[model samples]
Target: MNLTISVVLLAGIALAVVLRLKSATLTGAVIALLFGFYLADTDAAPTVNELVTAIADAVRGIGN
Candidate 1:
C-alpha cells in the first residue's frame, strides 16, 4: 500500500495497543481503508461501516 495508508494503519494500531484507546477491531477498519482506495471500482460505504464496528469495539474495550 501507499505510505499514507500504511502510516494511518500503524497509527491506529499504535493508538489501540500503546495508548489503550481504541480496540483490536480498529486495526481491521484501518486496513480495510486500503481496499476502498485500491478498488475504487467497488463501493466505499462498507469501509465506514467497518470503521463504526471498530469504534464500537474500542468503546466496549474501554468499559471492560
Candidate 2:
C-alpha cells in the first residue's frame, strides 16, 4: 500500500515536471492519466502492481 502511494506520488511529480517544461501538452497528459486510471481496473493491474513492486525492491537493494 505504501509503495503504491509512493509510486503514484513520484509519477505525479514527474508529470508536473514534464508539464512545466512543456514537454507534454495538457491534453496528452490528461489522456495518459485517463488511460492509466482505466488500465488499473483491468486484469493487467495485478501484473502491473507486481512489476512495480519488483522495481521498487530492486531500487531499495541498490541503496543498501
Candidate 3:
C-alpha cells in the first residue's frame, strides 16, 4: 500500500515533467491523496511532525 502510493506520487511527478502539463501533475497528486487513507498507516502526530520538519528544511534551503 505504501509502495503503491509512493509509486503513484513518483509517476505523477514524472508525468508532469515529461508531459509539461500542470493538470496532469495535479491529477496525480489527487490520486495519491485519495489512496492515501487506504494504502498507508500513520500516527497523526508523527506525520504532522515530519511534514513540519520537511517544510522547515525546504524553507531553510532557500537561503543557502
Ranking by TM-score: 2, 3, 1
lDDT of 2 at 60: 92
Worst 10 residues of 3 by lDDT: 34-43
* Runs off by more than 4 Å, candidate 1: 1-42
Per-residue lDDT over 1-64 for candidate 1, one digit per residue giving the tens place of the 0 to 100 score = 6554554445445555533544447555655565445444446557877988999999999978
Tell me how far the alpha carbon of residue 2 in candidate 2 is from the true structure, in angstroms, after superposition.
44
Candidate 3 positional error at 35, Å: 25
Following a full C-alpha superposition, what root-mean-square deviation does model 1 have from the true structure?
Answer: 10.7
lDDT of 3 by residue, 1-64 (tens): 3544465456445555545654556666665564454334444547766898999999999999
For model 2, state the Cα shift of residue 49 in Å.
0.5
Which predicted model would earn the best lDDT? Answer: 2
Tell me which of candidates 1 and 3 scores higher on lDDT: 3
Give the local distance difference test score of model 3.
0.60
Report the number of clashing residue pairs per model. 0, 0, 0
Position 28, candidate 2: lDDT? 56
Computed on alpha carbons, the lDDT of every model, listed in order, comes to: 0.59, 0.72, 0.60
For candidate 2, report its TM-score: 0.61
